[model samples]
Target: MIRLALIGIGTGHPDHLTLAAIKAMNAADLILLPRKGDAKSDLLDLRRTICAEILTGPTHVAEFDMPERAATLPYLDAVDAWHDAIAAIWMREIGRHLPDGGSVALLVWGDPSLYDSSLRIAARLGSVAIHVVPGITSIQALTAAHGICLNELARPVLITTGRQLRERGWPDEADSVVVMLDGGCAFQGLAADGMSIWWGAYLAMPQQVLIRGPLATAGPEIMARRAELRQAHGWIMDTYLLRRERAAISRDAPTS
Candidate 1:
């Protein structure tokens, strides 16, 4: 039986690793880390650092080249195909390393329940006993670094992707939205009348950057800074939460 553990490691920060995640890493028979080309070598480096600090058992570490998604297909379709390819690569690696199928672990960036695919890939393993060790997420770090609560009292929060925000615009009833995986500043097109935004890039890491204020005023600044940092580092992992003001909500609502 394959005992698979999906361990959340957070945004490349050594401190962001939870004790549970560290334990899980040490318990695994094999650990797999994917290299997504030279542009994101930092990801592999971070995994290596984590392995150095945590893996105590006789665990074998392996690196596999991650497949890139084709840009020609529809967005969802392309992502689905990419994930399939990733699952195949993982299967190949696991078979090569642990033909007997023992305990294995993959260190995921941020919590697996969030915008991560490690858990999904593990599900494709079939009949495996799966375990999830939760760790801090980029959203958690974003809120903590900004020193703000995620949602207002008695309000619901919607967590979504950059693509959703850009394509659908703001949902009618959402007062607070946490946007992740946004390559473009989707919040810029938002009606920023009285909405406040808290943005952070590289959360919980040494190279963290933050911006917060009324969206109208801070939007451009965040966009400019995001571009600068992305150019400087060649990659970035960022998240932001936007809360529309009560007054602005009332103004946007039509009178009955």
Candidate 2:
């Protein structure tokens, strides 16, 4: 039985880690970092930097090659197959490094409870005790960078993926929508009128870029900036929030 610690590293920023995350890193017997090839070497490097800075104890660091998802298969099937492959890789890495079955840590971006899949992958490893150490989420970082509240008073905020936003358009249940894992800029598909948007790329990172304004006016700017950033970095992770005009009537509405 292995004690699996899924530690949130918080947007690749060293300062974003919480005290609990710091303690978890120091307590782990081994740390597994996934490498996503040349295009995402920066991510691998950032993981390395985090470990080097915080893993003061004699914790072993293991780097594993991440498997790519199948493009041909349907979304759900493809995701299932991809998760299976990742679980296999994770098991292999763990067996090779710590055959004795000890504490292991995998640093995740943002909180595991959000759009991250670390928890799902860990569930595949049966009989393992899973512990989550939460950290600052991209949503939190994005809102902070823009100095805006995520939701309006008496209104609900729906956090979803780009695919959902594309397929469902604007959800009627939510006046405020926060989109994650949106590689194709799905917001472009919706009508920009009466909607305000705040977008951030590489949130809390050194090369972070933020844009906020009316979607009609600022949407093109975000697209251009996103294109330029992606071209320069070879990869990009971005999130955005879109709110309808009526939601802004009372910005200071009570959240509780």
Candidate 3:
């Protein structure tokens, strides 16, 4: 039986790695890292740094080229095909390294239970024992960096994606919303009359940036900064929390 460990390595920070993740790395017979091309070379470099700093044992580290998703197909179909291709590459690499099957580990960004896809890809392996070592999520990192609580007392928090917010606008009864995987600043179009926002990019990294205030005043600044950062870095990952003020909620409510 093959033992597969999906260890969460939070965003690209060395400090983001948990002790369990470190232990898992040393215990692995093989580890896989994916290179997403030169535009994201910093990502590959971070993984290499983690391996160099944490791998105390004789574990074989392998790097593979990440497969590109077909952009011409419909979104879901493209994703499905891409996942299948990734799974095939994974199995091929694992087979080439461990012909008889052994323990393998891979670094996943943030908690695998969150928005990550490593666990989904691992499911394709079939019949393999899986272990998940949790790491700090982007939500945690974002909130901590801004020195704020995720939700107000007795309020529900909704975690969603940029596409959902862009298409549906804000959800009803959502006291607080955290948007991840947002390529665009979807919160800019939100009803910003009485909302507060906390936005962060590259959380916990040296180049991290943060902005927080009343949404009306902060939204444009956020968009401008986000665009600048993306242009400067060639890529960007950002998340934001939008909280409705009590007065705004009361005013937005319908009367009988």
- Using TM-score as the measure, which candidate wins? 3
Q: lDDT, candidate 3, residue 135? A: 91
Candidate 2 per-residue lDDT, tens place, 38-103, comes to 999999999999999997889999898999999999999999999999998988888898899999
* lDDT string, candidate 3, 1-256, tens digits: 7899999999779899988999999999999999998878878888999999999889999999999999899988998889899988999998999889999998988899998888888899888899999998999999999999999998899999999999999888787999999987888777888899999998887889999999988999998998899889888888989999878888888899
TM-score pick, better of 2 and 3: 3
lDDT of 3 at 208: 93
Each candidate's clash count: 0, 0, 0
Residue 36 in candidate 2, Cα distance off native in Å: 0.1
Candidate whose lDDT is highest = 2
- Residue 184 miss distance in model 3 (angstroms): 1.3
**Per-residue error (Å), model 3, residue 218:** 1.3
Question: All models: lDDT?
Answer: 0.88, 0.91, 0.90
Candidate 2: which stretches are off by over 4 Å?
Answer: 247-256
- Best first by TM-score, ranked: 3, 1, 2
After superposition of all CA atoms, the RMSD between model 2 and the true structure is 4.1
